[model samples]
Target: MADLDAFLRDLAAESADLEALVADLPPQDWTRPTPAEGWTIAHQIGHLTWTDEVATLAAADARTGGTTFADLLTEAAPRVTTFVDEAAAEAAGAPAPELLRRWRHGRTELADTLRAVPGDAKVPWFGPPMRPGSMATARLMETWAHGQDVADALGVHRVPTDRLRSIAHIGVRTRDFAYTVRGLPVPGEEFRVELRAPSGELWTWGPADASEQVTGPVLDFCLLVTQRRHPDDLTLRATGESAAQWLNIAQAFAGPPGAGRKPGRAG
Candidate 1:
């Protein structure tokens, strides 16, 4: 059974972990451009902060259905690329300290809201509502993903943690959705995925003997699915054509297909 309390605890840990590195940045570093296109470190934090507020609102409301997060962006701006540009533009002018203040307070409130919501209650989101457990997991995944951009800007190495198990699990579960978002047909057959978790334990999903398979370090798989790193840059192996193809364009988050990092060009 999914432990909502455990999930919330981990989610808080992720938030705190990222905030530590960000809290001490020198003033100029706030405007440093990260690997994520057109996003300074401040913009990345701003985006996360903005999304956090929306998530908190969704959690408190049971009538959660409307434009998905991606669609919400599209509706506000013509291209997904520009969706966050406007917000980032305005935020860039704020003092870096203020930005951090907003994010810190917002995330704490979001976590509190998650803890108060009943486990089985649906929370409205960009798309269909997610149960509290799923909502918490999704928040953790996004935090880690965006945190990667922050880490890169600072040129700091982040050690893999067992919390990645949740992220990798979501990646595996969303394999078909990865293809679907791109309007590609999901492979008819199942593909097994085996991961070596950070703690040296094997975390297996799908079938062990399936013809199509993906096997690699949990860290690599998580980065691939989050579209933070191109599959070619990782040590992951794909056994069949379907699996190989899936690796090329895998995306775990909801949205239009992300223009993932390019081979030999990841920032």
Candidate 2:
């Protein structure tokens, strides 16, 4: 496993990168449709902020042993929905500068909260309870995925980094999420992933002798798992039937099953 501190730092960095991208968009741009059906850039950012707030509450609940983490999330869902909807509506008529300002505030709050939590602290998540470190990684996955949607709406490309580790962690750990969403049994065999990082180093996870292989640049792997880009959009290659199939439906974030948007749709 990667160092917990390093993982949290990466998550914060990615969140900062995303904030910079949306900092100066035009007012209308915030309302422009994203690849996510019926969601705008504001909606996406709002979703991130909403979830982070829920995470903070869950973390607090875990610390107190007030209730099971699962129960906390169940209670948080309705609140999350209301927050996103209200935030989206509030941002709908705001000017670009105000919208960006609000977004920056929310992002900073989330990032700061994550940093303040102890590494070993467990929190309620969509899946099983996760340590603060893993939860931070999961937040990174969400930011990158939604950041891609925002970039696509503006006809921009984001050159992601070696953050494939976070995406891969979500990919493998959320295997049951994929299976449950598709109404299939989770496969027993692990899949090996070899991706070239932005720093020109190779990052490998899972056993080398695993039955399935997913090899490509780290950016593509991240994009694929996030459902930001189609598998064919990059040079990702899968060697086994299970690997190939997983690639087609990979999703790192929690929610409903993502059938994956078409390639051109993101552009």
Q: Highest lDDT: which candidate?
A: 1
lDDT of model number 2:
0.74
User: Which residue runs does candidate 1 get wrong by more than 4 Å?
Assistant: 63-81
Q: Compose the digit string of candidate 1's lDDT tens values, residues 45-149.
A: 888888788788777664344345434545776655565566766666678899888988998888787777765678877545688888888989999998999
> What C-alpha lDDT do the candidate models reach, one value each?
0.84, 0.74
The residue-by-residue lDDT of candidate 2 on 195-242, one tens digit each, is 888898888888999989899888888778777777778789999998
C-alpha TM-scores of all predictions: 0.91, 0.84
Model 2 residue 58 distance off true place after TM-score fit, in angstroms: 1.7
Residue pairs with backbone atoms closer than 3 Å in model 1 (clashes): 64-124, 68-126
The superposed Cα distance between candidate 1 and the true structure at residue 208, in angstroms, equals 1.5
